[model samples]
Target chain A: MSYRKAYLAAPLAALLPVQAAAQGIDETINTIFADYTGWYVSLIFADLPGTNFSWIALWLVVAALVFTFYFGAIQLRGFTHSIALVKGDYSDPDDAGEVSHFQALATALSGTVGLGNIAGVAVAVGIGGPGATFWMIVAGLFGMATKFTECTLGVKYRNEYPDGRVSGGPMYYMTKGFSERGLPGGKIFAILFCIFTILGALGGGNMFQANQAHAQLSGVLGEYPGWITGLLLAGVTFIVIVGGIKSIAQVTEKVVPFMGIFYVIVSVIILLMNFDMIGWAFGQIFMGAFTGLGVLGGFTGALIQGFRRAAFSNEAGIGSAAIAHSAVRTKEPVTEGYVALLEPFIDTVVICTMTALVIVITGVLNIDPETGLYVWNSEAGRISTEGEVAGVELTSAAYARAFSWFPAMLAIAVVLFAFSTMISWSYYGLKAWTYLLGEGAAKETTFKVIFCLFIIIGASANLGPVIDFSDAMLFSMAVVNVIALYFLMPIVKRELESYVSRLRSGEIKRFKS
Target chain B: MSSEVFVVAYEGAQDDPGVLGYAMQRAAVEGATLLLVHVLEWSPYSFLTPEELEERHGRRAKEIERARSDVTGPALDKVKAAGIEAECVIRYGNVVELVVEEAGKAGAGMIFVGRSGSQSVAARVFGSVPMGLAQISPVPLVIVP
Candidate 1:
């Protein structure tokens, strides 16, 4: 039977699942998820009729490019001011209650900078060869303008409560922005966005993070029950989310930055150790971008992998960062937009590029001396690696070649990254939950409990279909949010123009030199 | 009354009270107002959790209120009871810099600060508040142990 038909018959088929019991509960759950949700996953990820390029990736890339041209490349023009804003050079002391531009950017970074940097980049480079890094950086640069537009609208249209709380995101902008323009379907779009956000939160945000954490732990500590890692992670998350324990969040917040710095330092050390190879790595990346370096589908394959990973990694048009940046304490909405643009630059341009460089410089991928092309393994369907590893493991192997202790440290970092990502996504999901269900303790707690439970399920099972479905839900958010951005770009443009003129006239005073 | 003011670098109730007493005596002797400055150490570049970000505004307001009512307010009352005119300034930033800036703005003849009792290596190696003020304070600095 078809997967769609399987989903419909799941309830009745639930009685017939005893056959897979000998394979363990994880296997059984995986089978069920594959059977029931496979159709939805296939639909969301379905490529163009003749091409391997995902329409969702194209949707995001096109929107980013559109924003780039429309804003006069604000990401480049306003780059200096964005740095100044983040440095608190223009911040007014009176605006003390709002989150500082730096804090907002850091918080948003913690959310997007997790597994995507470590694992996702490896996947792109592994399949697309070095050339994928070029497209990834390009996508990241264009995505900055998209972040500028959405975050500007996010702050402008945010809902400020009497008690100093804020609620914003694609949902708010879609509803308020659409209605303000006298457009129909504002509320409908908002509701749809929230639904997608909630699903995306539970699946990609919570479950996928939990699964990866479990994988990392098992990879290092030896195989144990996945539920043990899940329970531990869930219990810790539950305390933070339900009990309002700030200590874990505080610790993670502090460590995540140090972890990022440490990761960069190690990568730099490895790069320096292979200092002479830097130029060669760049050559591989550039040549691979245009010629695919002997990868499958050649040029198109490299471009697709690079763009897909970057779009997934940085989440420029996904509208999640908008929610986080919306809380910045600034009277000038455009200022936050300037600051938000840095998110993609830091996430994709810097961190992801670092990963790709390390992979290439370490000589992890085999290259045939005759053709000077990456030795693609037909059986594995990707470039052959030094350790026959993939994803984060490949990254670990590359670094471990330099430092034997690197993998253990990476394991800890992976857990921390996953935990922090989960916390940030929980907030995003909670905001969407409150928006849809009308905000009460009981309703909010209901969502939080379910979220924590999904952590257990995610860690315990190899639910590929579930992850794919949630990933689709996450990308689907960009679809609805980007459509509204097209309508709302004029508002952002007006705000930007007014702010710039005032700034030029010295009507907006600088608080710091 | 003289136009001169003495800027007292108040840390908190946990700080040594000798700075406030010394500043008050000098202010009374010179017939100048005591400018008690309290700074809550804050950096905009610091990392914050999502919950903290959401409640930062409320927490900041509450922090200002608590500093006013619990720390600076009582110091002002003590100065007023001593028959010395006094006011207070509370802000959030680097302590040494803000205190020095407040002294400059108040055009104080002298700045008073308590000796930092921190024996931590970071304090000794990096310099303490008193050390910082000693290096940068435009006016005369009084370190009351």
Candidate 2:
């Protein structure tokens, strides 16, 4: 991702001195990126032969399935226990005013629940049809196990400093867990993970969010230049991270989660309003999953898009949630695992499903009356829809069907989601940067400066391949993270077994009703 | 055990020493014991990051230490000098509820609380602990100026 961006950015940087002489900067940048990274993008997002499933998406789904079985379907068995943990039922009240399982989950959800559910889901249904929703739900269910496994290990092998700050993620776990198992290459694996994490944080977390947010703002507020938005985001980020305006930061943290709840509530309202079509929408999703109906790629198209979107949406196997969940104040690490598993369920199974149902029930997808399938818009390579729309716009249009003002609401949601994701990623990236450079005032400040710079570029520059490359970096993180998980999952199993047994015996006391 | 007991709703703010002084004198005169109750204003619904969550144990430990060193410990010494038996409690929750509960548990004859002096609009709008305790106190309430 970094290489591709620099390769594309160098000439653009040179053109800065002569922008009037060399016009069409946006088109030029897009063309250069598309040409240079086409092969790499294909390799990253390549389909598996006759099937539509990308290998990266397959890797995530397979890992989720493996964990579901390996942990004896911990997601399902521990679901209620996870809810209890989030609710602080078993938490000691003496330790109140700290991060609860719910807070960690909320923070992590803010990271994943951004544009993926809004824009990414629309892209899926546009191509894969409503049947893709079924696959997305399935993938999400399995993904819960992956979250449980990673977060259990996250808390178990975290670094607790003298100052009471804790740091945990694939980097900590890969190094610590691997070393605990007498492995020699833990440090190298950890270093690789950190590198990927930083890059992923910059591209997907920072730049992509800014870019998408700009796109949304422009969609609503007219064809305003992107830098204005970029400057605004950069300024806010600078104030919070650099200026040390904690009150504003606190308001932001609160805003992100409240917006998330608000989005879900609105989706619920739309669903209830379309009450009669709910069951019929499910029928379409189920039938489309197998038959593909008017959708392209038959059953495989729907499954691939669903799996891809779910992987992107909830981010279970990516190991980012582990960082957030690791801070949970529980003696039993398994409690955090239970709490973490709820993330995928909420992000994918609930939020994404709500978005999909609203899209389907509203009859946004163009359907062939004869075939009773989603009308295939082969040029767009997904299911055809009214106006041939895709991405966040399609989701906006669908919601607008229920309420005319919804697109405007969605635009606000898009910007908020994008901004919140950027902020969370800033933290994630900062941690990775610190891990690589060693924690210090200077190193941290330097990383923050670069992060701010990228937010600007992401908002202003139309570098399609660069963002795509960053997304590749994100998927690459899952690759390294899951490899480390394979080595470390046994330890998680041991923790889960012990916690579950003790709970069954009433050893873990519940202090709250 | 003393026949009479007095509870001081001590937040240990600027006027807390005055409140404690008033309560200590009253207790000594009536041959009553003292309960120096300090509530470390906290809510379960407050937002906390993961780092804050991990440090909750240490933070709670510090809250208790601070309560002892800053408020209850000094007040306890003052009461001892006055020849009145006194105990301390540092708890977490609503100030009014915790203060009243501690007073009731100790079987106190009266509760002493500090006034906010100005009775500013901000305090009235947001609601003050002293006002809350006055409304809810089970026993006779004394507002220390």
Candidate 3:
């Protein structure tokens, strides 16, 4: 990487000191980002004493489990109805929510279904081996309950302005739901959630997206000054974000879903092409989940990686989906919950599993012949994947094995995924920002300008600290959001019970059979 | 018992008033009740951001109101003045699809659609609402000049 930089960066250095100055700033930002964010990161992701399990992960899992039982497994019971809702089958003209089920689902899926499904899955499989796929699926299934619970509360407590604007999220529910129940501390938790969401929008949603888009672009275009990519991305994003192009959102709402379907179709084609290996691949996945398949720690290692990546990819318990789902048009808030539950399932259970199966079936992870363990890349200090690649590159390489031209397609998909995610997060971050700073044109523009600048920073800077800080902030959102969920879930339960009874008794009007 | 219905697909652009006027005359002659169906041009499948989705219900309602009051209301009044009972319908969806659907629902005998002025490349390739109606409307579709 350094040699490529030296070779590619010579002209920019000789022409001017601009690139040099950017590098210096990158180092300073990285250091400061790491220093200030390290403690918070460790605190959220820390392993429980004498166990590899993280309290954060456990908190999310237990909440999902409890919600699953409390609502009598609403995820399973309402799964078909959720599909029906999205298809406009049960949609009533008088019961319009803000957005359609499809739009709300698309918006939330765009946020969760980005590089994490591609890159994060690769990393999990690299470290935990094939067994991780099984656990990831399990985690994603339970996560549906979590998404259902929180989004129901989101709509129940959402603030709809008379002018037709709507703002509802974890922050609103945290305060409003708690206050309604006569509980204190909702104010503080809500405030903390907003803070985390703002920082998270900057780091995970904006910068990380910019950063990976840069990496993919540079890989395809040959090593170029990162700032060039950053500037181009930032400029385009500013036009779309600040310019308020409703058409772009419409285009993405169409395109992102198209891309997702395309990705899965290709995955299906690859699996069919290697038709004989499908069963064996499932065997490896199932066996690995329990026995750990000679990977470092066995069952526990696979379980941890599966849970962590599923959480990262689907964000079921994070409460961010509530923000997106709350915007859905539904008279019954629980109907949105039914719709929101499909997000984690689509993201983790379906998409992530496709990437995982492709990696395992394509024989991407290098295995030690004698020990049958995943080979560690001593130089890269990670598990050696096919062609000694890792992260998103490994997923790309695995797909390339089926179609040599797939890497280029994957690159395009990555950038589109990043772009859609950034736009969505800009909204998420803006909502939080306006909540804290108050609504005004100047305030909104200020946050937007800063967001666009961070896009450039994310694209231009080294990923080490930027990604680290963002991932931490993103998880930190979960820390506050989950606490709110615990308190607010009963509210969701009441909604679910009423909605279900009405639905069964033919009280909830269905416009379509 | 002269309660026959005539469906007029109203775009309400420059050429639309002329087409609607013709429909009103035809309805008056036939003693048919006029059903002015104005479609707001919406696709249910289009994706929306959080902000867009949040304001969608309000925007859609506003769109419906504007189409009804501003576009169809005057036409309906003019037709009523011409001794033809008229009702206005505002809907959201493809112009051709909604026109046909509303026509069937209202039991209209004929449909009138205006030829939009701009015949740009996109309009040519995608086909105009009148062109679509010519291909698909169950009732007789008249393309007004």
Q: Pick the candidate with the highest TM-score.
A: 1
Residue B71 displacement in candidate 3 (angstroms) = 2.0
lDDT per residue, candidate 2, A21-89, as tens digits? Answer: 333544564576568657776888888888667898889888988998999898887888888888889
Q: Sort all candidates by lDDT, best to worst.
A: 1, 3, 2
**Candidate 2 per-residue lDDT over residues B10-70, each given as its tens digit:** 8775655688888877887898888888888876566654345556657777778888998
Query: Which candidate do you rate higher for DockQ, 2 or 3?
Result: 3
Q: Which window of ten consecutive residues has the lowest lDDT sum in model 3 chain A? A: A91-100
DockQ of each: 0.60, 0.44, 0.57
lDDT per residue (tens digit) for residues B1-145 in model 1: 2578889899877553688877777777788888889988888888988778877877788889999999989888888988888889888888898888888888888999999888999998999999999999999999999
Give the deviation of candidate 2 from the true structure as CA RMSD: 5.7
Per-residue C-alpha lDDT of model 3 across residues B38-107, encoded as one tens digit per residue: 8776665677766777788788778778777787777777777778888887776677887898888888
**All candidates' TM-scores?**
0.93, 0.89, 0.92
Give per-residue lDDT, candidate 1, residue A204. 73
**Of candidates 3 and 2, the better by lDDT:** 3
Candidate No. with top DockQ: 1
